[model samples]
Target: MIDQLFLNNFKAFRSASIRLAPVTLLTGLNSSGKSTVLQSLALLRQSYDSGILMSIDGDTDSYGGFLLDGDLVELGTGQDLLHEDFASNPPGADPRISIAFTTTDKQQYGWTAQYVPEQDVLPLNLAIGPSDWRDAALFSRRFQYLQADRITPATTYPRSHHQAIGRGFLGARGEHAVNFLRHHAQDVVPEGHPLRHPEAGGHTLLDQVVAWMQELCPGVNLEASEIPGIDSVRLSFGFGGTAGLDSTRRRRPTNVGFGLTYALPIVVACLTAGPGSLILLENPEAHLHPRGQSRMASLIAAAASAGAQLIVETHSDHVLDGTRLAVKQGRLAAGDTAVHFFRGNGAGVEIITPTVAEDGSLSEWPEGFFDESENTLDQLLG
Candidate 1:
């Protein structure tokens, strides 16, 4: 797992270091540099996947560089990624953007990219830190990144054999989720895994996913299948008799509620998590109700307890409280979780981390850290 992330001259940050844990929650207002954190990691992942962050035979520009556009993240030119107010460099040295990280194994890895305003590739002047660092969990094949604006209720989703089957990617927008599920539905979840729901019908991935989805809407069941001759897959939902529906009839995603489809990618990602998995989620609580949001937090906590590192960005207070409850109930240790509050003005961004106690209470609560409810209540009661 990554123990620390360092950003220098990167977007919106002149220099910043963030400590990560098994479960890290990034909460704050919109555009307060929260997405920037996830973007940085995605950028590196994209660059590496494109062979732009690897070592070169002789010339640094021959092979390794930062790919500004790639499968995982599409950052514009260097000017778009470089910090507006970059810190000063030594005399006669050109400005550059750098991202560095230290793993729990005490391995330090970093990369530096030259800035070119209109160029899509920011040529790197240095190779990845160590040869062995390439095997770190962050670079493993089990990594998944789900952006905030994900696929909503849809009739049919695309099916790509290479991506959904070979790579097991859920797509940045989770467009391949249906295809992935169709391909891996029967795969058995590991025993003693937190993702293995007690009420699940079996140890298969689909069974666990259905068990978790039932939390958002009881008696709900899902199905993923392929179109007869098209390069697409279909997703449908069914409600049992308890939900006033015929259990035999299946409804298309468009007919079902939005939360189910909206939360499908998150559910699949968490259920697939295992040792050395790095899952990055943006607003997993989106479109979910209060109790459903808290239940999602419990799933996230379970994934972390199962040995995956999850970094989630959320604005829901229930998500925060649910994570705390996980710690109190000993599902996750206080030391294995980190909560950060990002606050930004027009000029700069600030991040405050409140420590979690063994009892699940936070050491500090910054002004805007999920306290809007109390603020409004004070106004009404006064």
Candidate 2:
């Protein structure tokens, strides 16, 4: 859904503009500024959702304060957090982030945020510009960003309040995963019904998700329940095998495998997102096996086809392959997906754009790019 993104004096990007498709895949080696692009989009969307942007107040004791500290520190030190080459201009130069995107209905929107360094504090300013075109009304929704190290596996469970689990948005680290489910239980199912009714699209969404997960790991069924004394909800899994079926459910999230917990939010987002929504995901393939990773890619493509605009930063070749497969299967059109690879050089990082042809083949592939695993294997073998 996003049409374009522009960055100036931000992180490793001195000045760069990238065109976006319905499903945009950002792949690069470590420190190639892939996460920076997602972070910028997250901040932009956050600003819009919150309706105001403030400077990094050093005294606040919240996550926003920490984010402010991190952003300013990154800017002040001019160090590439991911080990890439990131430099600040001579002096007195302001850093700015600008994003231009179009909604599903074809309305265009642009937002620019600028930060000016001061003696001991930095002043942040935000500006909302007119979209180049207009169609439908645009609403601000929460931006989702999943870092590589922060993924929570699905095998974990959370505390619950009742037998019924609700549905809500999953937190970044999946901390509120169970609570999210419990809160949105109504959306998960219709009133006075145990099985999903035909008219309830949300039920169908969950069913599709379960069906897909079964393809990855056979005999796995997911259900939600609320804890007796807690306000949170927990997830339980039923396994089928030769020995009678067994079920293992936990109230604490720490018990499950990291992959399931981490991938759940992605699945939920894909199933729940509506038109004009923007989802920014970093390393959606983290902790997933090759097959699971490929399946995840297909899920993302399906979400985009359903009208959500997704920007994914990944290092998994399976993810790329999945996208290509989606194109080949006619689930996604060639023009609907864009793949950008970032390569670092003395001048900074340059981006290579790969086009998906009608036959689902890439127009070109960059050298020494997106082969982190292969490069490591070669070094070890040699």
Candidate 3:
């Protein structure tokens, strides 16, 4: 697991070191540098996956450097990524962007990319870390990054053998989720795993997914199947909750309410998390009601307890409260969870971390940190 993330002259940060916990919750206002934290980590992973993040041979330009455009992230160019107000370098030295991280085992890995405004591939003049760093969670196959702009409810989803099967990846936008689910439905969840839904019908992955989805919409079960002679998969739903209703009738994703389909990737991602996993989530509470959002937080907590390191960027107060409830209930330790609120401070972004106590109470709640409901209530009473 990554212990800390350091960003120097990257995007909105001139120089910032963000602490990461087993389950880190990053809450903030719009453009307050919350996404930048997640993007930087994605950028590093994408660069390394493209064979451009580390130096194997003496030559650093061709074989290794930061690949700005790739499968993970598409940061346009050095100019777009570099911080605008970077501090001056030493005499005759050019400006550069650097990203580095220290793991829990005290292993430090860093990369420095030259600043060429027009070029996307920032050639590294200096790189540090051993090749064995691939063993780290960041480079591991268990890592999942679900961006905010995910796939909407549709008739059918794409089926990719290499990505969904070979790589075991639910696409960045979770576009391959249905296909991945169709393939892994029969796989049994590890015994005594936190992912096992007690109310689920069986120990299989699909059962747990349906059990969890039922939290959002009671008695809703889903199925994923391959389209005959096509590179697409179909996701259909069945309902058993309504009295006197026919549960056999199937419902397409377009018919099964947007919240469940929109939140499918998150459910699958959390259920798939295991030891040494690194899951990056963006607004996992996007399109759900208050209770459903809180239940999603419980699922996230369960994943962390199962030994995955999750860094979540969210805008939901219910998520925050639910995570605190997890801590209070001993599902997650107070020390193992970190909550950071990001806000602009006139000069640059400021990250404020509050303490979580044993009673699901926070040590501090900054003025703008989930205080909108209270503020509005005060106005109504006045």
Model 2 lDDT at residue 170: 48
The regions of model 3 sitting more than 4 angstroms off are: 56-63, 241-247
Q: How many clashing pairs per prediction, in order?
A: 1, 26, 1
lDDT of 1 by residue, 131-189 (tens): 66657776777899999899999899999998888888898989999899989998998
Question: Which digits, one per residue and each the tens of the lDDT, describe model 3 over residues 202-295?
Answer: 7889888988998888888888888999999999888883211235788888876678888999999899889899999999998899999999
Best by TM-score: 3
Model 3, residue 97: distance off in Å is 0.4
Q: Model 2, residue 333: what's the lDDT?
A: 88
Off by over 4 Å in 2: 49-51, 54-114, 118-126, 131-139, 151-168, 185-205, 241-256, 371-382
Candidate 3 collision pairs: 52-65
TM-score, cand. 1: 0.95
**Full-model lDDT for every candidate:** 0.87, 0.59, 0.88
For model 2, residues 305-333, the per-residue Cα lDDT tens digits are 76777889988899999999999999888
* Candidate number that wins on lDDT, 1 or 2: 1
Evaluation by lDDT, superior candidate among 2 and 3: 3
